[model samples]
Target: MKLRFGLQARFLVAMALVLLVVLVMLGVLLQRQRLVERESEALSSDVIHQLVDGYLHGQGRELATRLADNLANPLYYSDLDAIGSILRDQKRDDLVQYLMVFDTAGHLVHDGSAEIEGYGQPMGDPLAAAATAAAGPHVQATAQVLEVSAPIRVGSERIGGVRIGLSMAVAHRFEQRNAERLRGRIDELSQRHQGWLALMLLALLAVLVAAAWYVQRLLVRPIRQLAASARRIEAGDYSVQDHGDTRNDELGDLVRAFDRMSESVARHDRDVRRMAYTDALTGLTNRLAFRESLDHRLMLLRGSGRQLALLFADIDDFKRVNDTLGHEAGDEALLQFANRIREAVEKYGGDDALLARFGGDEFVILIQEGDVRASATRLAEVLVAELRRPLDIHERQVFLGTSIGITLFPEDASSATALMKNGDIAMYQAKVAGKNGFRFYSRAMDHAVERRVHMEQELRGAWERGELSVVYQPVCRTSDGRVVGAEALLRWQHPMLGTIAPSVFIDVAEQSGLIEQIGPRVLHAACTEAVRWMQLGEGEKLFVSVNVSPRELRRGDLPEVVAECLRETGLPASSLHLELTETSVISDELQAAALLARLHSTGVKVWLDDFGTGFSGLSHLRRVPVDGVKIDRSFVADLQRDPDDLALTTAIIAMAHSLGITVVAEGVEKESQYNLLAERGCDLVQGYWLSHPVSASEFTHLLARRMR
Candidate 1:
């Protein structure tokens, strides 16, 4: 069936036709009025120009120029009164708005109108030495005025210029009178057609009334009902109500469909809530649900003097299981692990406990009431013990341990977010102290973390702020006590905190990922300083060793970063040594060897720092491509006092020598330790016993002394 015109379509078409006719009539009337006004304005402007030019010609150019110059002088107020009187007498049709004069030097000498504010100013642009009027009336302040300018001359010499501004009020008055007559004619014409137009509008209005009534019955009533029903549905009122549109039409079908959709939405709502709050893998509460529960619990426990404990539990070495087994096994392990935690919570935490899985192998447990230290500790121990049991995953046994961090509500933190963060920090501490343990949140930890966060922010701008500097500790030849090289130690001088130790900020930088940015800055600064030292005679052959963190080495760009620094500073790579702690390279020997090989390729020396202090032994050391080993300070600090330390240091130096690698002894604080290290065939020794770390300039002076 073909569709008929709706009530809305017919109504809009009738109204649009009427509006178009009305607009056309008004447009024609306006256009005719504009043309009449334009012609009248041009004629009036020409007449005004002739009057002003005749007045200036009668005054004579020399006398006019002199009078204008006097009038323009702001200091001569009496001259302005005289000029204003002369211009006022010359005005015939009350057309002149203002008058101005410019001297031969282009300085504005006179302004005659009270409307003009500035006098005795330079004329930015002078009209040619001729009479001319502007194309149209120019606006000044509020009213439109015409401007005409002519040269003021003495015989043949042009002395100045005179300008007259004519007001457009007279011309505008004539245009208004014509506009009024045209408007009256338009009104009479409109009155003549008013009856017909009204009849047409009345016919349209009758049709609109009829259509509106029909549309109200046929469409609008049902749509309004459906909207009301939708609002009820949105407000979670799912009960089916009578739609009241019983006509056998599409509206009736739509009402029925709407009823069905409300039922479906109600069903989906439950599923959505479950999906939002529950983890799919373990069917346990998710982070969102945990946070909600935590907030509710915190509100209830606030000021009650009652204690609540939040525990953050993490699986130990979960990544190893994922790597060794398959991802499927990892998923299975997480499920089993979550189940164990749930079991433990049931056993020790009682019915008041709320258990949630924070994704992956991490879970959280809340005890509504508990002893701050004692009860929380017992619950954590139970969970750790329960998680230790082997799980049968795909017929293979898998063992796991958990670390728990516990925080009390009123004591540790007041808000849900702070409580959760404190628990997380405590959990990290437990893992750090060794997994399969538990730690309670303490203020000391918060202070340390806060300090870390503050330092991280400060260290980001430290290099740019010039707060970081390199201090050189002299490295000497053990054989003859002659200086060979110096280790560059980084120091931070915080504006507020004074001098901060390297250990504190460096650890923060590594954790906060700022180390990547700070490392290259230190490297460049040290290289630049090293180049300065290398210029000195004794330090020319001396190498500057810069410490590199594991993060920097893992980036795979250390070679490029170091090379760039060397290239920019003109420091030979061979004279710059990159030092890495044994822990940095011992984890992945192959990757470390690749990185060291690249640096080695650049003619830079690589030293395994803190030797024998890390996990790797001499066999692993032989695999790493390094040029030397630095004996850890622990051994050297005790070298003279402890027989075992002395034996260990001697053996390290001997073995390193046998492998064609040099050995540097660090922390030789006492003369005895230094003498003993020298006797042990150590190649280089660096410690306070000889000289402490000094500033760049001071190191330069030390190099000069050694040369002398």
Candidate 2:
């Protein structure tokens, strides 16, 4: 295990090391002092011993010389009592160990004793031999005694020299006393130094402890607090409390920087959250935020008996605005739409209602309080009406309508995803019914949506599987009853679903963006078939009309596609006619006019199909370039029965002729209807009355018969 040395622990450890070093130094100092004391004591004892030894030696020599002088006189005079008296006196002093006097013959005359038993006898000891042989004084010393011998002489003449011995016991006793005294003094001084050194050590330790406490309080504690604050910040608590350290140090600067960083992080977090949940252009809650809110609300209302309503809204023809005015204008429209919807929901929907932009031109609203259906319906209606009002986008008045679909909780769906899906499905239904309206979600809508989805998936493979084909309906000149041209129609022969109507699958194709592919194939086939028809007719001019979907027209490549098809099939451009509905042409008249002008310049005629069915037929005729217009089947079906239809048909024919536009009456199923169209100078007619749409071989046979 690794040891973690924190700030406080490290500080204390450092102080402990310093204290240990101080202790070691103090111990060494005390040891040195002791060593010095011992050395001084030894030196003092040696000095004292030398002085005492010198003094003892000097005294011994002086006394020996004096005695020798005195004894020499006595010996010369032959007075033995004199030497004996001096020896006794030296012994009486107690410092002498022993004293002896010998004659020139080396005999002991006297000893330092009360009895003179061996007096006048010859001394046979080595001391007597050495003393008798000495010409002057001699000295010898041992551990216990000091011996000195002096020869006595009278007037420089040797008669009978007297020798005396002195003891060193007095010098030894004096040296011992002096050495004891010096050692006592050294011991006293050493004890005093030890006491002072101990006090100093205590003072140093106190200083070290005080320093450690100060460092821990001033530095370590604040650092620990900062560490704790950092931990809190790591845990996402950006609000850090002040440590209240007023020191102008690095730590203080660090604390201030941390506080500022916390505040900055908090601000950045808030900004990121807001950007994540808000739409940049609309300033509305975005799809992610809406989905999260929906899920949360659904979870809360799971067991609650209350109901919630989800309204999904989409802007109709939003792409037209973008294509016509630019994306900037489209953005302005969306912003205005969002503001209007927000106001509408707030005013009509209860306080619990929530609104969010579901991306692009789509928005969603949630209503959970009181009469969910009524409130949602009211809000949706208000939104549709309010959004229908023209918006000033790029300084132009642009009309953008909204279609809303409302789905109720636990009725249309039980989950957020299902509710959103159903709501979107109903919104598509509203768009289908008409723009600027609202619809409540229904199970039928869901089934229809599913069917459409299946059909779209199947349609992708239909052309490859040979299930799709083009049929031709002949159009005849009304006056002569002669076939002039044929309209090419697309048919889908599904293996499982039998034959499907163009009304059903063509819409599916448009919605799924498959028409862009399917429309070109149909155009190519029609042009190829029409080339054959032109061959059959020989010198006659018989054109083939092919219907173009609005999606294909909006692609801006339709003219190029048509030209390419004509070129590939070897069909004359004048023999191929492109038919478009009024809605397709009116969606963006200027662009449609430009596209049609391009087609016309290449000698391909453009016709308006389903003419009277749209809202702006006359306006489209004026704005869009077209060579002819086909009367819608609805008006032709009831032309004789409904006077209004009759009047509309006649008025349309007259209006077209006045504008130098050819008119074709379609869906005429009766001879009477054909006769009425002929009388009205409708120019051409095509319906089951003449013949139903047939295969290429049948149409070729018809063209051959017409040539005959």
Candidate 3:
């Protein structure tokens, strides 16, 4: 059980018990000494009475007759010198206060001394009266003396008592002297006992003081130190001094244990801080730490006239490696990448540069107190080179590259977040320029990013705001110069900025994921327009080819969307042709083929749009199940000017025809281009030579003209 009372309390109680016992012993000793004094006084008084009795009884009768005759007639006994001499001989005795004699008749016959007050008359003293009344050996007391009377009788008769007077004052004086002696002796004894009592008290006091010191050293002081240590721990000072190690006691053990606890607390605090700031996988500073470090560096550079540069290094095509090899391999690749970058930083930028993992596939670095841009660019080059080295991940060789973007303090950006953002923008510019490259941040890039962001935000609401529309560019048969179909091109008419071209917004739409929303609207509008065209009494079959974005194709819902558009517009699927770019259908070949086959089964014609422009080849025709290919306008535009263009276009037409695929010639504006395409047996031609892109109303008139 825990101690309910403190050490001091228990110690005080023990001392009090000892003191109480001592006091009880002293009181008993004093009372016993007082009782012995009273007993000794009573015994001395009895002895004094017995000695007086013997003195009176042992004296001879002659002494009594002489004293009696002298007392009977003091005038006549004035001649009795014998009695005077006897009385005078005992006058100075300490036991005798006075000496006197009385007649046998109890009358004063002769005064033994002339100094007697009632001489030569009857001695009417009370002692003599009591002695006479007693008759023989009568002991009586006057106020100051005891009188012993003896009858001078021959036989048993009493003559007159010879009264001998003894002083009661003398006995009282003796008793007083003895009592004083006894009191002095008792006082002496008490002083000695008092000395012992004082010693005992001193000893008790010394014991109490020693106990207090022991408790203070062994228990109180250690407990106080422990409490102080705990307070220091609470105050976050883990490096407390150790005070418990010197003694070989429980308190010392407790102090040592507390020291261990303090050490553990300090270690745990360090570990928590490290985990918070460092990445677990790579042991590099994490994003939060990066931001904090950047802020700190900027503060340090504020007045130091030093510049800092931040670099954002993004691993290019890391996703491909991750998806192909698995996440474990991905983690290993990241670890290796981190190691290489750190090495490059240490070599080129030194310890002043900070390296951290911003997150998956992205790392950041800061160069401080130096030529920021120049050093950063040099370090970026080295880092790119280092990261390009092949890594062994899960025993599989993998090659990776880095694109770095640099932004400087007080130049490209003034704040940490701004610097990081500018760096990110420049990094994206490097990716856009080409992977495995680096770029320094420019204000133009910042403006461009801002513009892109603004356009993205605008494009998201463009469909709902009626800013988006479909412009149909007529497609004609090259042989007859007649319109047979039109390609649906998207246009953005900004409410404030007038009309925007597809090139301006389509790229932004694709990047911002807004293209998915725009794609369905375009399909629906084109289908509705085609149905409207059929409703016009032109009496000709006109196919509407709507372009599809790659993002829309990758969505894997293009077939369903097209079917819904057809169902909503009540347009026959055969009349609605969905044109997909080569890049759109080539990324996922299986999904693209499946989606295309499904669309084909729905009686919808799938044309490969911008066909000779991308990485797709004639083999894609055999695999993608497309009904036709549109020759890119770049090839068609330079038909007469560039012989290579004419040759490539002619070869495309031949290969497309060989596959029994329809050939659509784009951007055929010149007569020479059109004549050459006709000579090459191109199936369809679309360009400004026939007509620029027109609204549905204008296209209706064109169809009316063609029907006429």
> Considering every candidate listed, which one attains the maximal TM-score?
2
RMSD of each: 36.3, 4.5, 6.8
Each prediction's Cα lDDT score?
0.75, 0.83, 0.77
Error of 1 at 52 (Å): 99
lDDT for model 2? 0.83
- Candidates 1 and 3 compared: the better one by lDDT is 3
Whose lDDT is greatest here?
Answer: 2
Clashes of each: 2, 0, 11
Q: lDDT per residue, candidate 1, 1-708, as tens digits?
A: 998675456655665666667557656755665565565455545554455445434433434344444444422343556666666555544655556665665566556566545566665543322332322212222246445555554545555556665555754665566566656665676666665656766776676667777877777667677788789878977664756556677878897787677778877877787899999999999999989988987888788888888899999767546644568988989988887788778878867889999988889998865564676788888888888777787775556688889988788889999999999988977876767899998978888667667777888888889998889999999888888889999889999999998877887777677889888877888888878877775334888999998777766788988888888999988998889988667655656778888898889999999998764467766888889999999888876568998888788888888889999988888888878877778899898989999999999899897798
The better-scoring model by TM-score among 1 and 3 is 3
| Ten residues in sequence with the least summed lDDT for candidate 2 | 158-167
Return the TM-score for each candidate structure.
0.54, 0.82, 0.73
Q: Per-residue lDDT for 277 in model 2? A: 96
Clashes of 1: 2
